[model samples]
Target: MAARIEIEGDRCIGAAQCVLSADKLFDQDEDGFVVVLNGEPDGEDLEDARTAAMICPSQSITVVED
Candidate 1:
């Protein structure tokens, strides 16, 4: 199973920390806000996704086990 990823738009402060940490699972929108490229992260990506969540300056990233 993969992990469910979520990003709170309002909480995002245009920081690309998540992107830097997990480019495979995250990206930035036109506005520079963080976006979840993959809602369900694979086993290997799951760790990166979780790291992205912690690396997020605005704490906008969320990973839920599905």
Candidate 2:
């Protein structure tokens, strides 16, 4: 199965680390909160997702895999 990225909007502080780490997989909304560009990411994008989750200060991003 593919990896799925999940963001807890309430936990996001609009740091945008996700965007900086993985622009292809994540983006910021008008309010500066996290907006998922691709919920399911693969290949290099999946690696970026993991990086984003690790770098997120607020720990709002989660990558679930099976």
Report the Cα lDDT for residue 45, model 2: 92
Least accurate 10 contiguous residues by lDDT in model 1: 1-10
| Tens digit per residue, CA lDDT, model 1, 1-66 | 656988788999987998888898888888888878888887889999889888888888898886
Best by lDDT: 2
Give the per-residue lDDT digits (tens) of candidate 2, residues 1-66: 578998889999999999999999988989999999899999999999999999999999999998
RMSD of each: 1.1, 0.7
In order, the Cα lDDT scores of the candidates are 0.85, 0.94
State the weakest 10-residue window (summed lDDT) of model 2: 1-10
User: Would you estimate the TM-scores of all the predictions?
Assistant: 0.90, 0.96
What clash pairs does model 2 have? Answer: none
Error at 41, model 2, angstroms? 0.4
Candidate 1 displacement at residue 49 in angstroms = 0.4
Backbone clashes in model 2: 0
TM-score of candidate 1 relative to the true fold: 0.90
